[model samples]
Target: MSKTVGAEGWTVVHQARQKHYDDRYYGQFLGTRKDGRWIVGRMWSGRSMDDGFHDGGWDWSKRFAEPSSTDAADAALKSYVEMSHETFVWNRVFEQRVGEAIDAYWAGPEVPGAPRLSAGWCRTPDGLPGGSTVGLPFHEAKYRLLQYLRSTESTARADLSPRTFNLHDAVELIRQANGPFRFQHGYNAYWLADDAS
Candidate 1:
């Protein structure tokens, strides 16, 4: 059987959740009986030994119910597909646009005692680039987003005080904060732009 779709006399029509580390499947299964009855099984593979026996170190279980009619089976499967589509949309929004924005936000360096510009990339009066781009701990986008959410927000501003003004430090600061902020994409960006209008 195909991991994503059906094949070889049966198909995994709709999956409620991905297979667990224990190698158990959770989803809807579709097949045709020799008598032409449509079998739409509620699959909860590896739930228990009674539901299914363990084989080759993998838990396997499924309980099928025949639909009253082909029309009913088709409708039920269609509903599952619709629900899956809705989840796909939200996942895309969170993982793509929101993820990209957050990465862009943290891509900037936030070193202490650095100088910064008013709008564009941070640059020194001598016209040299500033700051270092450090990599986050995890290589995944989701973990980066989590780090961003858990990080403490700093109110440090470029116009702070009459402290010593170093051009090189200012340039470094601007380079550190040169990317789009976390709220600059996804629905947050959209709403912000709408409000600006």
Candidate 2:
């Protein structure tokens, strides 16, 4: 059996208790509501089942037997709806206002009793002067952020900070390491040299 924990801490247990109901390897699952029904199904990639797994596809009939009663279906459907709504809201909020959302979640009245997070500077594995254990090498992080910004929006770089700056450096390093740049966005657009970029 294999298990996975989602970002929200939901535990999904995939046990091979029955061959008929189990695929050779478990893939990601999503709980969703559709046509007034609640369902949990395997996410499939465009490739065949034998291919590597990718998170997508939610065909219900292949995963479970038909509901025994309308009441059961309704209850299941409601659960799926709630879960879907939660996931959607989380992603949307994180994408549009990550800083504000983080501030609200950590400091808001909802967490009145929560302890404050400690702040400090620490050395990296190689003992760089301003390094910390929490992030990747500065170059690597910057490259990844650059790639993300290119794919998403030009203003994405505005949110870059030391703590969240590794992704952009990573993308640039990868490009330089591999060969000449192939990305449509110019290297300067990421503003990698600027601390605030």
What is candidate 1's TM-score against the reference? Answer: 0.21
lDDT over C-alpha atoms for residue 154 of model 2: 45
Tens digits of per-residue lDDT for model 2 on 41-90? 34332233433223322323222224422233324433443443332322
Task: Give the range of the ten consecutive residues with the poorest summed lDDT in model 1.
Answer: 186-195
Runs off by more than 4 Å, candidate 2: 1-83, 86-143, 146-182, 186-197
Candidate 1 backbone collisions, by pair: 6-11, 115-169, 115-170, 116-170, 122-174, 122-175, 123-171
Assess each prediction's global lDDT (C-alpha) against the native: 0.31, 0.30
Q: Best candidate per lDDT, number?
A: 1
Global lDDT of model 1: 0.31
lDDT of 1 by residue, 6-66 (tens): 2334433223433445665344333333332333344435453233212212223222344
> In candidate 1, how many Å is residue 2 off?
9.4
- Best model per TM-score: 1
Cα-based TM-score, every candidate: 0.21, 0.20
